[model samples]
Target: MRLTVLGCAGSFPGPEAACSAYLIEADGFRLLVDFGSGSLSALQRYAGLHAVDAILLTHLHCDHMLDACTYVVVRRYAPDGPYPPLPVYAPAGAPDRIATAYNISGESVDDVYTFYGLQPGSFPIGPLQVTVDRVNHPVETYGVRVEHGDRVLTYSSDTAPCEALLRLAQDAHVFLCEASYLDGVDNPPDLHLTGREAGEAATKAGVGRLLLTHLVTAWGSEASTFEAAASSFDGPVEIVRAGARYEV
Candidate 1:
């Protein structure tokens, strides 16, 4: 499996990064993990606007899902002609949230993408084995675990430290985790993870690599974030860039 970071900035977009999005590909199938604010523009850099085969939204938070509304416009009005509806796996009420963001009714957008409600379990998407579990977050967020053959890729959508996340990411090749708070900050509980917390989880899960993301400089320190993760986890660690790609 191949992983591409379309956007990784957290809460809001950075000057050079979008909010939160990732592209996972294997067997010629492209699965989008999240379509956050400003990510659609970044996505066009790595693949065609119409090239995405399916979408998996972690939650309805604007930073993680707002651009899906923009995607409806792209697919609905593309000059090449409207393509077949894409499969969209997302949290319950996703269609309504997306439609409301688009300023249209849910039924109107339903024709553009087939929506599947996400739950805690495993399923198949194309050639990949996919699993999702509820995470500790304000909204109904989900962290995804994708496996193909012997390789495993897990993404922590947006969450505080939780056992379900660590269990889901066990032995993963890559753990794409969110670290929105700094090492020494007194962050609130059940909202986000500090960089140190993310690294500790990766260590406990025995992941091959830890790619920390979801940074908002306005609220957290970026340089210190990486430092904190590195101090806790003994593995390859990086604060993912907007277009960084990795093989799993």
Candidate 2:
């Protein structure tokens, strides 16, 4: 399995990166996790506009899903004519929320996307087996674990420290986690995880490697975030870089 970092900036796009988005490919199947703001353009760097086979959204936040609105336009009016409705798995009320965000009337959004409400369970998407668990976030968020053959990758979409996240990350070959807060600063509860927290979670889960992501540039330096994570986790830890690819 191959994992590509499409974007890693938190909350909003930074000067060098977009918001959260990742591309996972295995056995000729392409799956996209999170289509955040500015990600559609970045995605074109690595894949054709229509190459994505399926999408999984962790939550409905603008930084995580807003680009999906623009994607509808691309799919609906492409020169080849409208493509088949793409499968999108997201939290409940996602269709209505996306319709509202896109400001489209009637079933226009539905014409481009076939929405499926995500639940806490395991399901198969092409060659990958995915397990979803509810994480600690204000909204209905899910952390996903993807397994293909002997390889496993876990993504902590956006969450505070929680048991569900640890369980989902257990024994994962790569733990892609969000580190949105400064190490020693105070942050709102049930919102995001600090680099230390993310590292600790990875340690507790006994993951093989930890890749820190979702760094809010305004909060502090990215290097400091890496330091904070390394302080807690004894295994390999690195910050995610956009356009970088990892084999799992």
Candidate 3:
């Protein structure tokens, strides 16, 4: 499996990076995780948007799902004409909410792309097997563990350190977790994780690699933050900077 970091900034677009978005490709299938603000441009530059097969949204936050609605329009009205239906996976209640937000009719959704709302559990999606788990967040959110053949990739989405996250990512080849705050930043009771917490989770879960994302724009150099986080884990720990790629 190949992992591409289309965007990695937190909250909103930064000078160097966009928001949260990732492209994972394996076995001729491409899956996108979170299409945040300005992600389409980065995706087009990195992983061709036309090559996308499916999109997995972690939540409805503006930095995660905002671009999804616009992307549908772009694909449908492309000069080359509309392509086959693309599969979009999301947490429960996403279809109705997003459809209303996008002003799309259900009848018009005939295959060119369809939304599949997932409950909290394991399920199959195309050639990729997925395990979804609820996470500690203000809104209804889920983290996904995607498996293709013998390779496994787990994404924590946007969540505080939670047991479900550890369970979903345990022993995975790659753990794409969110570190939305710096060490000293005082986060609210149930919001996001700090860099150290992310590292601790990856170490406890026995993840092969810890790839940190969703970093606050004020977090300074990603390399420095990741180095600090790595102090907690013996395994490989690195920040997912914009335009970075990893072969997982």
lDDT of 3 by residue, 94-201 (tens): 666555656755434433567788679887766889899889999888999999888889999989988999999999999999887777656686788887889899
Give every collision pair in model 3.
85-111, 85-112, 85-113, 86-112, 86-113
lDDT of 2 by residue, 1-248 (tens): 89998888999998888899899999999999999999998899867677699999999998899899889889888999799899999999889888888875635588889999999999999999999999999999999999999899999999999999999999999999999999777688999999899999999999999999999998678888899899999999999888989999
Q: Per-residue lDDT for 189-237 in model 1, tens only?
A: 9989998999999999999999999988777788899999999999999
Cα RMSD of all models vs. native, in order, equals 1.0, 1.0, 2.3
**Residue pairs with backbone atoms closer than 3 Å in model 2 (clashes):** none
Consecutive 10-residue window with the lowest summed lDDT within model 2:
99-108
Off by over 4 Å in 2: 104-107
Could you tell me the lDDT of residue 22 within candidate 3?
90
TM-scores of the candidates in the order shown: 0.97, 0.98, 0.91
